[model samples]
Target: MHNAEIAMIGLGVMGKSLALNLVDHGFQVAGFDLNSDNVARAQQEAATLAAMPGKGRFLAAANLTELLAQLATPRVIALSVPAGAVVDQVTDELLAAGLQPEDIVIDTGNSLWTDTEVRERRYQGKLRFFSTAVSGGEAGARHGPSLMASGDPSAWQYVKPMWHAIAAKVDADGMPVGPFDDGEACAAYLGPAGAGHYVKMVHNGIEYADMQLICEVYHYLSEVLAMPAADIGQVFARWNQGVLNSYLMEISADILQTRDPETDRPFVEVVLDKAGQKGTGLWTAVNSLQEGTPAPTIAQAVFARAMSSQKTQRITAASLFKAQAKSASVPDREAVLDDLHDALYCAKLAVYAQGFDLLKTTSERQGWQLDFAAIAKIWRAGCIIRAIFLQQVTAAYQQNPALENLLFAEHFRTELAERATGWRSAVANAALQGVPMPGIGSALSYFDALRCAVLPANLLQAQRDYFGSHTYSRTDQPEADKFHLTWNATPRVQQAQ
Candidate 1:
């Protein structure tokens, strides 16, 4: 099985990494790239590489025509490219250029969920399509990507062996449930075309929120606590010891510790502060709003990145700065750390909450039974955002399968109560001193959302009465159909049944 036919399209960072991974794992891989240089180099590299664990050999396709002719009829084609209309165009090209109907085409790009659905139906009865989300960035792309795949169930079963060769392990509960044995825990046929993308969309959304919140904590420690980035890095390193620990926080520590050549200071300062979003965050926010789910943490992070881009407004504001900067009041370092830990933990939970809600809502809309607990476990390792606290989330879901939100989890509530006071104090301290802590603001908003008594805008029924003549009853009045027209300042028109 060292020569299983695999053809990879695109020779960019992700494509190159994955193509090489296939070559390493002993699978006979044929690689193609639009760029002449990259393709040639990849060809040279593939031929030179030795057999790796569970992968195959190497072949290079000079062009589309050559590649198609060289590979077996029912080839496994991997598409690693930019998302949106580009995917459709490329797929169309493949079909137009004599790609076989029995071929297995996998889209490893982070395409939109709706588009994946459309593509699946468009190619129905013609070919098998798998929409998979691959994580771990460029480096992880080669070693292995934590992949979420969804397509025809039978097709997924046929491709299971290849999927395992490319995925990390652990069941959905984050428990060390599966070995690198029977199956790949990190990858699964999430039930249909859009499901994988739906999960990945929410994944990026949570990522945006998590990174922004981390930045806030960084600012508080640096600007307020007068701690060095190196010290902050050390703290994050220590956080890995407990449930609050994660891969993002771990890399954050390394990033903080990395030094700059010119200033002899942390390289974090040298890097541009203006956070750049790649549209996934915005897409996640829009979807949440459309589905009537509250994704405040991720939404705030997108907004925070926007604020970072406004350097000129900030410079202008700083020109008239109040000369008296607040002097530091040294509280118990351990106690303050405890507060940060609690706040970070709670804020992170909110990020996951937003993402899970997105998945859940999407699942309902799509008619799929996606196990929430399973996603948590698979994310525990081999993903960019892997964190120790994922174990807690996994356990939380396991304890109560039917629970609506993570906030209602008993274990989480008990944990929050123990340290929430310090967290609140830390957030308040930043607010009092006029520090623009977007992450902290998001954390506060998350707390408020958890404790929110009533979402007034939840009155979709009243609006229904104003338009389509559907009626809603208050919590106190179960059977009443009268519309609450005074709030909208419009007369309600009741439709005869």
Candidate 2:
């Protein structure tokens, strides 16, 4: 039997969208899923799209054996299953099916990067394992998505054509470039082993911060300004016209504009406050802490989600401690709105700074030769966090690849400085109005901490030494030297070395 070009397992939403995208690129695709219904649906969808220009053939496989049989020698299979043990389970099944050593297996899910590393180690010699973190959601999957692929060079070479063909492309202005567009695709070999997943994790972490900041702005507008949802929706629409223009911001405006048919109320008003998470954001936060990377903005965003999940406890607490008066007097509505925009933009700078800083540290530790510029370029279009500002970021890295932080980039640094007053005013007003702005608040704190030349950590160390005997370093002493002082009055006011 003649083999197909590629095969995708697990025909769920993302999987099916990807399969169709592959088909649209003129690659014959074989798709399989445990559920016959999904396979049948995929077949029907593919058949409908067969008339489109560049459309390729689609084959539905009933089982693993059939799926393997349909693929050519040196088969390239994509696994879009859930993360965790299930990924390993599928890999073992493929290995057991007598697949050749050179065959390629690509995992396209939000699995932890560490797990990807382990999987690569375990699958060594048995088969070539690679991972690609896809962003842009279902629509992205079907059209174009930002792809971050990493693994063996040989395996990447085998799949690079498809990756490039299906990924989003952007022109010089960061506008979406079509399949026929004259621009580079938003896909690249990130690094070795788990670098792709790691970069993707960083993307999601920044997304959490971006989303939380927007929510804070919405909360302040709703509760403090008492603005109608439609009016607030208008504000988001305007924000999307400026540097804040992004996929997430665009959706936020849409969500606010949407009305509920049941009560004719704004859909957002009827939606529950409780938020759900799938662990990627938490993983980013935890990894940042483990690496001793200062990522308060991302960490605070994760904490905000955790705080949101306590809907029941919050309801009870609200009744016990009646709402307080506004934290501060509300300024003129127009003035406040302008300040809020600058505040949000400034906070966003901090979020990306922290996320990229984390990525830099991880890349160094893992020996991954990451291209920060390429990463930014990919995120310029297809990702959830794609923003016009990303174009500037890409430029910043291109100008200086060893950029320490986004805040240090001349463009962002100067902009943040110019926006400082408004940022401060927004955060202070939020506090005065009794609105929680953990994400923005943490960002401001991180910004301040970064600029501080000397912190009070010296005193903190002294206190720690006084109580727990933790050694303290003196300003006059080298970093390797440690000193301890006895706070209690005993004899020579004891000093220890």
Q: Candidate 2 residues 440-488, lDDT tens each?
A: 8999999999999999898888789989989987778798899877767
As a TM-score, model 2 comes out at 0.97
Task: State the C-alpha lDDT per candidate.
Answer: 0.77, 0.91
TM value for model 1: 0.88
Provide the global lDDT of candidate 2 against the true structure.
Answer: 0.91
Model 2 poorest ten-residue lDDT run? 322-331
Error of 2 at 89 (Å): 0.8
User: Any runs in candidate 1 off by more than 4 Å, and if so which?
Assistant: 1-4, 51-55, 170-184, 321-328, 454-476, 484-497
User: TM-scores of the models, in the given order?
Assistant: 0.88, 0.97
Error of 1 at 440 (Å): 3.3
